[model samples]
Target: MTKLTLSLAIGDYDRARPLIDGRVQVDGVDLVPSVLSPEETFFRAFRHAEFDICELSFSSYTVKTSRDDCPYIAIPAYPSRAFRHTSLYVRKDRIKRPEDLKGKRIGLPEYQLTANVWGRAILADFGVMPSDVTWVRGGLEQPGRPEKIALNLPPEIKIEQAPADKSISQLLSEGDIDGILTPRMPSCNLTDPNVGWLFEDPTAAATEYYKRTGIFPIMHVVGVRKSLADAHPWLPGALFKGFQQAKALALDLLADTSATKVTLPFVEEQLVRAKELMGDDYWSYGIEPARPTLDAFLKHHHAQGLSSRLMAPEELFHPATHEAFSV
Candidate 1:
């Protein structure tokens, strides 16, 4: 039998390592994986439809799917998940709390990014609305970042593109911007004492957030070209199963702490603590288990004006991926 060979674009994630290295295989499919930064992967996938399967930004995918004209279909296999508490960085002396972020100039790599969406949602937790901030959009470390697709947002939201010559990092370093919301650590924060996390200890905030919301935020989902899923109805579930198996294998290896596979210390203790907080399957990818996080994100997407309409979790995934037969 000939396997369906498809191109897959994803980030270099521990969960995806098994699939990337061929330790886990998608049934009846041969995926040609292209591991790259989330920005590059998402940019190529959304802008040019460059991959048959790709790790996609949940926010942009929500925007596209809600239009009823998206070219792709997603499985609930989230390749990236991070608590947004760490995504906020502020000038050490300027913004002391989330409330201070209101009416302040906040720099972001992209206005519609998943990180920013969740960041805004958390800010709302402290009484800051999306419309309250004056937003500056630019690359994190480079210049000239633009929205991948057109945005039809509410008039009240304030967004301005940074000057073509300057990046968000540059603006933050020069104290031109009060804070930055980015998925990665800002370049200026590493070497400068003046730039620090909005939360001094993000772990505490994340723990508190988990206690309040019971949500470990979902970031990226795996998408296939809708046309491909339409033509080959079996593909979506097969790929989902493959990704699940890949994640399972990765986690199984992580459980083996006798010799310490990862370079970081406290691997065992951290794993135990995470399970204590988030349960056994902490990084779950199933539709049933992810409903709350997905629901919360949909609400945020709508509230932030990223989506033209509120999207239901049921409508966001491929029909073929909704269920699986167990043996």
Candidate 2:
């Protein structure tokens, strides 16, 4: 009869909503949502032992390096490429080809994100080393403070802070940065005549890498306290079910324009983006952490010196609640 409080970082809520809103109810559990960005929520929860279940970015876990006594059971998210949505977008006027990026300034939200990692890998694929380009940081550019997630930066990396008054988009428009490594927002377009898709296809190298390595660097994971999981063993199952329900709801809504009309603007945008990137498989239930993808991530982490040793997939994910639910 006791309720389980789950805290998830802000952007993560879309993925966690099903468990909180739908799945827990069928198992006679209650989930409460707490709004916080992944880093703030993670540190707060870890410091105060605040929530029963939570979600945090994998970069956060690697950067904090404070897993001891942490009650959270790390769960694999639905397997997807590490840089699924992130990419290196260039301006067509400046860079006629990916090779042309060799000496350009690249803008990143932060130097520590998987987006940067993937960007580096993509550059490597194009034969452009880190020394070949200038790295610029601090690109969140909206009118508010940036989210506090760990950037997973190496000691040697220097982050250039952007001016507080200017947004990254504004800089991009003004030609301050040659290209940016970030997700494409609705207002942004790779084919906009101004901006060019640098890699042509961002996932090509990743797909090949997946075939070579069986691990995928997981970007985000759902974490729940071990004690909470022990006390409420049904929580994972319920959470999974909730996600399934949410996926269904999202899909149904996507199908019916009327339903999407009621959702948040960002959520609607995310749904559209999800469909465009992931296709029909986006709504499938359960987490499917791609091993090959994680392996590639480990290599990048080591290359960047973010981690000395690669974490095994088992070390990263909690044991499956059941075979059917395993990802």
Candidate 3:
């Protein structure tokens, strides 16, 4: 039988490294993997449908899915998951809490980014509606970055692009913006005295958030081009099984502390703490396991005027990945 040759673009994560390096392979498929940054991968994928399979921004995926125009169909293999408390940076003297963000100018790379959506959702929990703040959109490292997908936001939400010559990080450091909500830490935060975190203790805040919400937010999902999935109905299940095998291998390596797989100190202790807080399969993938987090994100995605309507967790993935067959 001839194998299907497909291009796969995803981040260079340890969990995905096995798939990238050929230790884990999708059944009857020849995967040509590209290890790219999320920004570049998402940009090329959304704008041009450049890859056969790729990691998609959860928020943008939902936006397109709700419109019924997405070119790719996703499986429930989440490649990126994060807590958003650490994603917000604010002016130390001007803003002290989430409530201080009201009526302020907050900078972001894009309004539809999954991280920013979660960041805004965190603020909403403090009674800060999307309409209460002016969002300044610009690139994080360079100027004039635009949203990968066109958004038709509601009139109540306000967003303006930063000057063509300035990045959001530059705007934040100069006090032109009161805060920045981004997936990446702005470089100026290390050098600028004015920049600091809104959550003084992000670890504690994130822990408390997990304890309260039971949500370890998902950022990215694995997508297969719709045309390809339709042609090869078995492909989505093969991809899901491949990703699960890769993730299990990575976790096994992480738990083996004989030489410390990661360079960080106290890796064992950190792993212990994570398991204690989030259970053994903390970074679980699949629709039902991640329903609450997905539902919460979909609610915020609609409420913040990104998605045209609210979507269910199952709607984000292909039907083949909804469940697995058992012996």
Candidate 3 Cα RMSD after full superposition onto the native fold (Å): 0.8
Candidate 3: TM-score? 0.98
Per-model CA lDDT versus the true structure: 0.90, 0.57, 0.94
| Deviating ranges (above 4 Å) for candidate 2 | 1-17, 23-28, 34-51, 65-71, 79-86, 129-132, 143-158, 163-165, 184-193, 199-219, 230-234, 241-289, 320-327
Return the candidate ranking by TM-score, descending.
Answer: 3, 1, 2
Q: Lowest-lDDT window of 10 residues in candidate 3?
A: 309-318
Q: Per-residue alpha-carbon lDDT of model 1 for 1-327, expressed as tens digits? A: 799999988888888988898989999899899889988888888888899999999988989888887788999999999999899999988888889988899999888999899999999999999999999999898998889888998999998898899999999989999999999899899977899999989999999998888778999999999989988898999999999999998898899998887999999999999999999999998788988898899999999999998878989898877877789
Superpose all Cα atoms of candidate 1 onto the true structure and report the RMSD in Å to 1 decimal: 1.2
Candidate number with greatest lDDT: 3
Superior by lDDT: candidate 1 or candidate 3 = 3
**TM-scores of the models, in the order given:** 0.97, 0.67, 0.98
lDDT of 3 by residue, 142-168 (tens): 998888999999999999999999999
Q: Show where candidate 3 strays beyond 4 Å.
A: none
Distance from true location, Cα of 47 in model 1, Å: 1.0
